[model samples]
Target: MITVPQLDQYKDLIGEDQLSQIYDKVRALSGLHVMHFNTTERGGGVAEILQSLLPLLEDLGIKHTWKVVPLDDTSNHFTAHLVDMLQGNIPGQLEAEDQQAFLDTLAQTPILSRPQDSQADLYFVHDFQLAPLTTLFPWLRPAIWFCHIDTANPNQYAKEYILRFLNNYNVCAFNSQASVFKELPREHVQVITLGIDPFKNKNKYITREQGMQAIARCGVDPTRPLITQVSRFGRWKNPWQVVDIYRLVKQHIPNVQVALVGAMEAADDIEANDVLADLRKYAKGDPDIHLLHDPTMIRDQEVNAFQRYSSVILQRSSREGFGLTATEAMWKEQPVIGTSSTGLRSQIIHEQTGYIVDDTQTSADYTLKLLQDRDLWRKLGQQAHEHVRKNFLFPMIVLGYLDALTKAMAFAHAQPNLSGGQKR
Candidate 1:
């Protein structure tokens, strides 16, 4: 079992004053128990965030529990479709049969029906997978629904279905202001962007020799200029656009290489295999174009190496809800070229931290520039690292959660009917 670092470990990165402020805020959350609900325990950003975060909460002397909602095949299929619709990746609403199947599946799951599971002081339901918990059990007071996807323009029917349960929660949190639906009251919503754990194996510091060795283990030459994108193989991630950008840059630097690294085993995303197949057909046996998706091959350390060794990192997402991969690359002190997606824009400060491009051509141009200009690369990389240290670190996220939970506790006390209501 990996041990979670104590809060004091971050003092050097965030300063003593910020650390003291966090301790002050955490004092108010003493004895609070927060339970987190999501679809999986080992894949995707939500899983990664909670994996790192829950431990830190424990270190802060706060009580917490993390749970993965049980999902049958039928439930997984329906929820997968629901995710697509909510993200606007597909068109159309859930049919009557779809909703019925989902409800029926939920009814069969023993965990959903158990009352003991609701013992936490506050419920932190994550993403669309468990959004219905608020509606199924209205007595689960002071719940906050954290949507970690791009939902600026969801399907009309899907949005309406989600709203049925969304209004029941004490608060709704999104990645950005643009992701906040206009239908939601301004006061009820909070914009809390996600962060990356710098101490993790995937983001921890490694020597140049170690990075080179890890890269060679994946069958890529560490000597050549390399461009890499670390994300899941999904439509929203736009892996194809990254390939196009690579090809454009390859025309100028013949020795240049591109690697598309993604996790193939996320439970909520059933479309990974299909997207990987399409990408294989598109790449058409270009030896320089490497697709590293096998879990056995690309684990956390390997991912860290790719991000650290790559000449330039790309996060060409069409729709993103706070790209953690971009932050990871930035933290590794490597310049990144990302699109104008809401998440990337929040992380990359245009020309200061990293370049934000509007089109594939512009992205490719930026990649070429970074590859050729060593001074610009180092300048942006240093600035990018500082940007993440100040804004998108795990401690910052803890502070955000502290504030949200404080507000929720205050609201629950004001409401007469809520159970376990108490003023802090």
Candidate 2:
């Protein structure tokens, strides 16, 4: 096990008051066990959050376990398409075969129990892959479905298909109030924003020299002002629009350079690759526009270094659940400019923490203003860091989950109509 000092390097943002409060809550629910089930256990935000969260929950004396549910390899094909379509990558209805394949995968994979006889006090399911649990196992322990995706009034086909999976959840939680899927059975919904772990490798402190070295290693000029956008290379992430905005800002600040650093999605969806290809065409060998595709750079350290070195962080996502990268950047005391849709709206405090813009031109204008005014940048960055530490860190998010779970358990016990499925 890593020592406390090492853990502190990542989690030092958790204050003593917050730690005491979590300790009391864990003791209050001493017997309650939390089991989190998701599809991929790596390469995504859900996995990264749970990796740190479950261990901390255990340390605080809460019985918690994280589990990765398995799906047929073939199903990933359809799932990849659905995930893209939902984000507006493609236009078409899911075929009958696509629909059936999803249902089949859900039915074929049984709910797994660890340690022979283990069940959970609360079962949390993430994203679409595990959604079928609602229909297939209505008698299972009262489960809460946690959605990390953008689901604002889902389309007719998606809403209908998702109903089978959602009705099973005792309560549903979304990242922002704006992303509430009002069409779903909304009676038991809650808006719990996603929080960051301040102690994580990406959010930890690095010297100014170290930050500069990391930027230099990426082949970017360490002396020039840098604007960065870190996200998975998906269309919804809007890397091309980032380029458009960077071009606009270049007229005002000729010395400013833009870097789009990102990890590719699982299996590299076809449309995302197409977008990257299209954007590269505009690059035209300009050193000012850098697209980094480094496989060795572990997520936290690289992101932390980039944000630390950046003059301003940019997140131009058009349709986001909550831009976790933006939140992470803000936590590092960096100013951010983002699109005005989805969860990005919640992260920015207008001109206070950062700026929210509706278009590329507006985002560029704000970027220019920040570059021109160093004192304003410092003030916004300081406030943005505190704002994230206060409202959006892991301890608070876990507390929200604890409170919701307690309420859900009470609600479940009162309703005899809802069934807890028999043992596997």
Candidate 3:
């Protein structure tokens, strides 16, 4: 586990005083044993946070353990389809036979059915995958569902299918109120923003020469103004509009270049490939328009290097749970232009930290203006970095979780019947 002093590497990012506050709060939660359960161990934000957070929890003397249960191999395809359905790509009822088939597959795994059987004091269930545990393990102690997706206005068809599992959770942790709280029942809702590690693989420092080398490897010229967006190419990420905005910006500054770099999350390959095809059509053989499928895995330090060198970062997502890429770019001291939807609205402080746009034309205009004006760009980037350091760093998130856990403990005790079959 990383020590308190080692975490001091981010002192500039997370002030020393703030770290002390987090440390003090977490130390108070040392009595409870926490188990964090999620679907994927390596692909998305949930897993990434668990990877960094668990160690920090341990360091703070919190008896926390992180675990992941693999979806049944035979049902991987159905799980993929289910993911798409929940994301608003598909809408319909799961036929009686199909529903049984899914349950049967779920039954093959014992993780959900045995949370109560474990020794932990609290269970933190992440996302919809393990949501059924509340029914299967009625004895599980005071479980909380940490939802990462936007559920503010769920698709009626999708909501009907998922509500059975959602209502079983004791409480829901959403990235933002606008993305989740409005339509959800007020009885069980908690708004907790996501955070990033300022000193991680994504937001580390890189020299100008190193950044240029990474851009050259991608075959993109570093001399020109660069507008880059890094995401999973998921449907809601709006990659096509990113390309359109770049084209509009190009009309104004012909020397401008755009780099759309992202990797494929589990079962998202088909959609990513489709988005890639659309991006290529816009590229039209232009070398300046680059699409990287898995650039970082192939070239270590490539993304860190790219953000450090880029003139401006673009996160024009249509529905963002939270824009970590924008926060990461801002941490690298690059001006970001993001949409005013969901978590993007919370991350960008209008013109103070970065620009917030409603459409491609507005995004393009702001991108051009920020890129051309070096002074404004630097100031925005500096302020943006400070914003992330103060609000979205790992330490801050750990503090929020500790506060939630403390409150949850008290809430659990007050319920008197949360101990499964044995009323206090």
Candidate 4:
């Protein structure tokens, strides 16, 4: 038989009072039919977050359904271009045809058809990819756009279209500061942090022998200082820059081995394979740099094992929604070095938990400093683990969503024509 854990089980970590507060609010969300729509079903931070979150919402007596708004190859090509637009790659204005294609693709997807078919109390759409779908399904109850990307900086045309699409939702959700998602001060934006489950399969405890075995399989040398960056092989993730930083670290600490572990998600990401292949060729001469994929590892749990075995983890995204990999690393008591902007700005507390580096030299300096002094990372690791436990766990994220849904409902109630969802 299948088993679901209790909400009160978190009391030991968060304390009785805190869990009680969560439970109180969670109970209020009972029978709430929540639908979370996103681009991919398996890859990236959004999918992984939903993997833990949707189930917990069900355990809390909320009817939660997670669906992927898939795109065809033709549509996905345009979608990838849209991702570029969000990353500020597209110059000048988006051609009117591309803008229409963006909306038209989402409109044609069958996954979104369920929103109009079923009676969901609230719609929680994730990322900019699915933001336009709300315009086609305003009757799907109160909608909240979960903008997981840095919307503040984008092509002017892309920003204009995104902000216009966002207006369809009653409110928008963000994890970073006001500058990341706020198009205007008047827009109703909910700042909710993304999270990771330390108790999940990847975050669960592993014996030394098992961890060593897993590391050995990844071709990571246990004696050498291991630096790992776990992210999709995307340009925005700055994977090439990460490899360059590792080379810089090698000059200072030659024994250091850098593991770039990534897996292609079933998203509309068209450039993943080309990027991964190019990076593989870029690191062909380096014996110390281990480039791995999910296919050879067999499962994502191995990536977790690599993180647990790592000396330090790197999530240095040039543009990040929120780097969940950094949180996963921190939870494992590993010192994480991430970039200083986007979601990484809020997660890594500079010298407190981990270092935030802007360039290769800065990253190398911090990596060398930590490697030279064992005591610093140990203390930082302890603090990093506590940071995730307190702020970025599954229970806390459930509460964040609850708070967003509450705001969405209130926003809906204020609308005389759009009044359909509950108020609690």
For this target, which candidate reaches the highest lDDT against the unseen true structure? 1
Worst 10 residues of 3 by lDDT: 415-424
CA displacement after TM-score superposition, residue 25 of candidate 3 (Å): 2.3
Best by TM-score: 1
Model 3, position 208, has a per-residue lDDT of 90
Q: Encode model 3's per-residue lDDT on 1-424: one tens digit a residue.
A: 2247546666776567867777677666876798887777765678778888887777677888777767765455555555556555366655667666876766656755554556688878887666676666666557777767755555566566666665555566777777563444664567777788866766677789978887788778888888888877777788888888888988988888888877565442346777788778867898878887764442437777777788888887877778777878888887788887677888889998898887778888888888779999999999988888778877767766776687667657664222223321
lDDT of each: 0.83, 0.73, 0.72, 0.76
Q: Model 4, range 149-203, lDDT digits (tens) per residue?
A: 7654677767777777665677777877644544543436677777777677888
State the local distance difference test value for candidate 2: 0.73
Please give the ranking of all candidate structures by lDDT, highest first, separated by commas: 1, 4, 2, 3
Residue-level lDDT of model 1, residues 1-424, one tens digit each, is 1223576788889887867777888888888999888888877898999888888888777899987886877787787788778776477768898798787676555765777766888888998778888767765667888889888767778888888777667778887788887887776677776778898889989999999999999999999999999999988899999999999998999999999998677777777888999999999999999999988889998999999989999998888888999999999998789888888888899888988886988889889989999899999999999999999888877777777787667766674122332322
Displacement of the residue 381 alpha carbon in candidate 4, Å: 1.1
Q: Candidate 2: misplaced stretches above 4 Å?
A: 1-21, 70-74, 84-92, 110-118, 137-140, 183-187, 265-272, 416-424
Q: Which model, 1 or 4, shows the larger lDDT?
A: 1
List model 2 lDDT by residue over 283-344, tens digit each. 87778998876557535566778887798889888788887788889988888888776778
Instruction: Output the better candidate (2/4) by TM-score.
Output: 4
